[model samples]
Target: MVLEKLSKLIAEHKDVDPAGITLETTLESLGLDSLEVVEIIMEFEEETGVAIEVNEKLKTVGDVVKLIGECE
Candidate 1:
């Protein structure tokens, strides 16, 4: 679900290698700039029914996965 969500998010932007992203890749590193955080959060809310407060503290993709798993 996470990868699907992430790939969809990236597809909304530019080309992304669905296989390129790994658990260790930070969303920021994938080019989801800080400004796109809100969009990503909203997508997660819709896709997983999770509400997240995005901030600099959310420093990695793992943080997002953990947060979504926590929602519920």
Candidate 2:
């Protein structure tokens, strides 16, 4: 569920190919700046109704997925 939602979000917001998204994918490699990540997090929280504490250490897509799981 997390992967699906996150992939869709990235595809829509970042113009990324959802099929290219993988757990190891880094946000920076996707050309996402810090502000963009913040916006994505905000949108994610709004959509999931679950607030996420954006961690600076979250460097990979997998990290964010783990975060969502931990938060839930």
Name the best candidate (by lDDT).
2
Number of the top candidate by TM-score?
Answer: 2
Estimate the overall C-alpha local distance difference test score of candidate 2. Answer: 0.86
Global Cα RMSD, each model: 2.0, 0.9
- Alpha-carbon deviation at 71 in model 1, angstroms: 1.3
Candidate 2 segments exceeding 4 Å error: none
Global lDDT scores for all candidate models: 0.69, 0.86
Write model 2 residue lDDT over 1-72, tens digit each, in one string.
898788888889878789899999998898888778778878889998998888788788898899888887
User: For candidate 1, lDDT tens digit of each residue in 1-72?
Assistant: 775676667656647776666667787787777777667778768877667766576666677666666765
